[model samples]
Target: MKFIISVDCEGPACVVGNAGKALSASRDYNFACREATLEANAAARALFDSGAREVWIWDSHGQGLNLCIDQLDKRCKLILGKGFTCRFPGLDNSFSGVVMIGYHAMEGTKNAILAHTYSSESYKNIRVNGQTVGEIALDGAVAGEFDVPVIFVSSDDKGCREALTFMPWLETVVTKQGMGRNCALSKHPHMVQEEIYSGVLKAVNCIHQTKPLKFKSPVQLEIDFKAVSQAVKALVYRRRGWRLVGPRTITKKIESMREWIC
Candidate 1:
């Protein structure tokens, strides 16, 4: 068996700052990335224990290059670069399962750790048919396109809740409970790692029982931005329910996955 692990920063044990916008390396963004990688490694170890012969990790954080590779489990291969159309790269229909690590809340989440969907400069919130979704959901939809299943996800309380809404049976490890988007009560890194290991093992062992992660066809995606000009750019796709949110943002909602464009 083979598994693909997608790792993101900002929702691990103690993440709190925006990507790159963090004031210093000591900021939550950087700290979160390292912690996120540890979680990924734990999951990879569990995958191996569950009969997975190979586990590939996709570094899906800011700039698509956040995971610390050398410290990762030697049993896995890490994909760290910004070369894919989607953040999750080199993933195809062949993998037995997919796991998301250190994912945060969707854009506009209230009191959720480091919340932002795609780009903060790009959007204030992103909704699909009026429902909020995070990076995990969009990436999972891409995986669903190929008939792959998202078996596990790791993040804070909000992120885990988001995943459960889409894929109820998938396993999750919540490392933090946010007091706000930038403030959260987190477990120690060691405890977080323990949960990651156990969660991944359970996910892989029960992969068959875990349902696939999918969205309704003709998916309606609303992209709300922080600027009006950005919303104007979406005018071209108006036929798909794209609209401007006053003079400061854009919103689009489609019901079918006629095409995946981002």
Candidate 2:
């Protein structure tokens, strides 16, 4: 079977504070990048050993250049960079399932390590049909539009719980439990890698038991910006069904998941 492994970097196991550190040019950021690459390699190896013929690893974190290409498993293709048409690039119905690694919780999730939606500097919260969502949910919805299920996710405890809310049958490996936005009780990097390897194997093995998650047609999106200026900037797309809901919020309606993203 074929699969897409999307990697992010804000989970407890990867960083201790300011999720953005994973993208910075600092010592801590460098360590987080290495750790993320190691975890991805572990998952990719497990998938190849478990009979996955094609595996694409998408670096979905900030700047999308976090994974170490030279060190990644040679068996899988890597999608790296930004300004793509979709968050999960090269994704389509052809893939069997998706695996999200190193993800965190939604914006405003109390005690969630480095919680935020798309951008902490831009968005305060994002909701679909009135339910709050994070990057995991947004990516999952996009995958669902192509009829691909999210089989596994590795993140902090809060992120795993958030994913389970929409995908109850998904396999999740918690790398840490958050004490707050910047603090968490994290598992050792080696231990987390082990869990990820097993998690991917179990998820691929039980792929048939899960289903893709899709929202109803005419999807409504409520985006609350962190600042009024950000909300005003988004108003430039007002003709695209955007309506000012509050000083810092805008609501829009779209026909499909593709539209919701665009």
lDDT against the true structure, per candidate, is: 0.77, 0.84
> Which lDDT tens digits does candidate 1 get at residues 141-183?
7787767789998888988898888888889988999888667
Candidate 1 local accuracy as lDDT?
0.77
For residues 194-240, could you state the per-residue lDDT of candidate 2 as single tens digits? Answer: 99999889888888899988988788899999899989988885557
Model 1 residue runs over 4 Å out of place are 18-26, 234-262
Clash totals in order: 12, 0
Name the candidate that leads on lDDT.
Answer: 2
Q: TM per model?
A: 0.87, 0.94
Model 1, TM vs. native: 0.87
RMSD of each: 3.1, 1.8
Any runs in candidate 2 off by more than 4 Å, and if so which? 12-14, 18-27, 237-239
